[model samples]
Target: MLRRSKRSSSSYYLLRRIALAAKAAKGEQSRCGIVGRSSSCSCSRFLTTGGIDDGEDDHDASTSSSSSTTLIKKRINDEYVDTEAAMERTRMKAAALKAAGLKAESMTVFDREVKRAHRDRAAYLQREKKEEKEKKSSSSEGDFLLEEATRRVLDRLDDIKRPFKRILVIGGATVSTVKQLLEKRRDVETIIACDSSEATLLLVKDIVGDAPKRKFDSFPVEIKYVQAFEDDLPIKDNVVDCVLSVLGLHWVNDLPGAMGQARCTLVPDGLFLSAIFGGDTLTELRIACALAETENEGGVSARVSPLAHVRDAGNLLGRAGLRLPAVDVDTLTLNYKTPMDLVEHLRMMGEQNAVIERRQTIKRSTMELANQKYVENFSALSLSNDDDASMPKPSSSESGISATFQILYMTGWSPSETQQKAKERGSATVSLSDLKSALEEKEEEEEKK
Candidate 1:
């Protein structure tokens, strides 16, 4: 019974070996050079060449053969190596993708940083705009007050009674009083109104309204409107008798050039009467901004450019070849319930527009903080003054506002020889020291008055 059991086990093992060999032979046949079923050059034929046949004795001999065992072992080893190589290729591909993903993440971070920088820049610009609006509001309020003061001066000038032939009105839009004065004077022959703003010219035309034809029949006065800059007046040299301007000269960016142009356009004996904002124009606002910046490091702190710094003005006029230049400085105090209200008045008067270089937008938060700081500082300072100091002596030209502005009124004439001389070699030169001296003298005169 033991011998029969052993024979059965041997037979099972032989059958398994034969099956595996047949599978390998079929796989080789599919991949080998053998084409037809009749071909003897197949793996099956090659294995059978060593005197092996399909029988019980042959099968037992094949199973015991070392060559067959070694072949089977080699095939199993090759299959294991192929599986491992495939797994290794898949792992390398996954690692490469992870590295690429990390690089993309780094690029996204850089892009976010750039966008943040742009947003910061935009915020800064908005803040600048708000501050500019505030400045314009203040300037407009000051201008209205100045117009009233100018009216007084005009009344005084009219009372003196000087004869004038041809009156050249530069920046005629803002000088309504001067225009009225010329219209009333019968001796005035021609009024040449010059301005860059077409809207202003139209307004001036409306004010005159056929009066030049009706009132002055004897002189037949002509009102000519010239659209020109201060530097480029479209008129004959040495032809005008008097040039009048108010709240206009400060808008000219190239003051010297504009002055030189004015000199060229004026007659030898022509008088130039002008009023402009000066260096001390917005003293209160400037002080407020400075105090705010110092107290809360969050507010904007930039110096406001004076309407007309006296030294610069005098120098500019002298450079234009004007003689007997008399510069007079005056302070006009105006009262405003709030800073924002003051700004609205300026907008109404069309004086809210700033020069291109000074133009900017301001942030709401910055402006609110600045206003609060200003109120605190102003109140504290006003209260600190001695109560017995004679009730804060009233100035010559004081309005209701707590703030005051210094405006410079200047009058000068073109040198008699300026018309005859070459444009380059004319009397258009004034020393800086002389201009400084003139401003100092004007300030001193104001104090004495």
Candidate 2:
């Protein structure tokens, strides 16, 4: 009498377990009547055997088969349960991720907006550069202002009696500054032109022709072009003698970071000079858009990118590890034919709004009303100025609207051994009391006068 081994595989006992317990337990029959002694699962021999009824053995075999089947079923059920639980967990995680994505509002931020502005500006310049080149005159009003700013920086350099050897122009609009420097500051040896927008860079031909061939100091001035973000200049530390940006820093998201990089790129006593639009730029358009949106769309959206304050520029420079930071404002009031004309000029000049969280679309009515309101409120059109024939007009002054573009100028000098340094604690030559007395004496003299 042999019993099946308990350690047998589940597959081996699977069929035996699936059968009825009574049938599987059919006991040891005669080995002589058409039966093989080695057979473990088949029950045909039980019925075929001659007159040997082992009912107890048959019951035991049936029980063993039933138990084996129950064990296999239990294992299958456990695996199925585990698989279902894992699937459920995966579904829950996916749902959570979807909800999280939906919850994040204002998907665009300032940095992303600036990057977009640069990319689009590049594309735009590439498309219209030929037209621009053909129509180029003494540059636009904005360009004139940038040139003036660059001149101011050059003058400041003169006042300091310092000469720049290597200069980096941080924005495409300031490419003229390089030529201006090369012509004016003959000591300058190299010029690095960097712009985030390739299209903007393409416009460099208008400012700088293939003309570094005009030698300086027994060698041709070196000209290098690199596409780089303001916050991330690709130059060695203390390599550039000056960093100049014109009508450009206003578009940067991280002004302080960019300024810091400028400081890092400059040699000791190097100068960082830049001019950017202040918060007052395009005030009329911003107001008109907000008013129209509120009147028509029930709420207002960001229609313009906010510019920086001149006051904040000084702090930004100090934080960038520069010395003697200076910030000042220069406001230029320009007249336009219409608000739309002003907008067109901005587009042409690559000054499109790069603000994140801007309105995806403006309603037709909203835009129409905005334009109407702009004409009514900002333009110089009186009731009598209306043409009943609706004749087309030429030039911006026809509609006669004025927009303010406030330019903020910033200057900071890279650290040098000769530059004035703050005195350490108790290191001053004069005591606090002595300084107070001197101030009092000065006030007394003024009062006496």
Candidate 3:
């Protein structure tokens, strides 16, 4: 009985080994490279020989030894070997991405998935913070820029003096902005708020729905929420009367595609007003990070996401098929007590590095190095009471960190016959030089009179 039990146990063990080997052969395999060791060391022998060694194998008596070995060898050669080769090719491609001093010039610079995750996390944290305080505040400190941008953009809507029945608010919404929009825009019957993060949508829905009494009572606007990316808006084309995005378009990987979609969503002659971070936004931080990473790690990665230049706004509008596009820049410089404060503010704003090839983690030493570099290179003297009023005042510290945010305000209208169109080329009735002379003659005649 004891001899029979031992034989059965050995057979079971042999079968399990075969099963695991077959499974491994069918799936892609990966091994992390250890310090001072090759990642493919253990698999090197198996890979070289093509199959399990006969001396180490304990096969079933009923199975033909040569046939079983041949089957396993074929599986490893066909599936396992090809998978490793493919993985090697991918590694080579990734290595090429690590070239020093190379800018993130590709269209695939930002990872949309990472951006979505960060926004969701940021929204969750913000909600938790508000709950901890047991009060619904108008806005948080990090959201100051967002609220300001929304206010400025919405103010432009007043200049048009037209009623918009349905408005699409791209990006997320804040408490103060929602209140301001509701109280100001009496003609807005519906507001469709779209964002990439589900948590953001839920939080905004709750806050706006539970706003203070009389804040939105008189306006009576219907606020709706949709979860979608900025570049890939899911709404039907030519639906909304207006599309407004504040401090949101900057994160889009394809700004032109996003703008094109926005134009298509607007009704004929509908307004498209937006504010995005310009190219020079956070120039100080970007430089500091680059220098620090180079000094510490012997290479630089995209610590700060790239932004569109103010000059690109007009051209992007033209590409998006919008009419009468106007682009302007608003530079907002803030003085922080420390560089770390600025970083925290960016996190609260849900604007962090989301580059696809970015390092998974930033070392503590690297952050310290970056902070020192930021202070050494970008620190400015605090403005006193006697200083010029136009200049921004820094914190109480002797030397305050300067962080610049360049906001690009863009306004475009959908195509319509009622809108003014430029005349065809060479069809002008008067020449520019002749018109100038006529104006000068008119001025002389007026002087004689």
In model 1, what lDDT does residue 404 have? Answer: 54
On the 0 to 100 scale, the lDDT of residue 184 in model 3 is 71
Q: What tens-digit string does per-residue lDDT give for candidate 3 at 196-296?
A: 76557667655655322224446455565444567655456677899888887777777887888888878899999988899898999989988988999
Total backbone clashes of candidate 1, pairs 3 or more residues apart or in separate chains: 16
By lDDT, the better pick of 1 and 2 is 2
lDDT of 3: 0.65
Identify the superior model by lDDT, candidate 2 or candidate 3.
Answer: 3
The candidate that wins on lDDT is 3
**Which pairs of residues collide in candidate 2?**
24-62, 25-58, 25-62, 26-58, 27-57, 27-58, 337-396
Which window of 10 residues has the lowest lDDT sum in candidate 3?
A: 33-42
Using all chains and alpha carbons, the TM-scores for the candidates as numbered come to 0.52, 0.63, 0.69
Deviation from native of the Cα of residue 214 in model 1, angstroms:
8.4
lDDT of 1 by residue, 1-449 (tens): 00112443355456547755985764432110111111110011111012212222322222223221211111101100121222343356457768677433332211222222222222222233335667788421213353454564464456545677677776623336434555456677666666554334444454444444425444456665543444345455566777777666665555665666666667676677777778786677777666655555654444354466777777767877777777777665554555554444443333443423332555455566557655555432232113222223223222223455566777777787543444465456887889999999999999999
Q: Where is model 2 more than 4 Å wrong at Cα?
A: 1-108, 111-142, 152-155, 205-207, 213-219, 380-399, 422-449
- Taken over the whole model, the C-alpha lDDT of each candidate is 0.49, 0.59, 0.65
User: How well does model 1 score by local distance difference test?
Assistant: 0.49
Question: 86, model 1: CA deviation in Å?
Answer: 87
Q: What tens digits encode model 2's per-residue C-alpha lDDT throughout 213-239?
A: 333554466665544455545455677
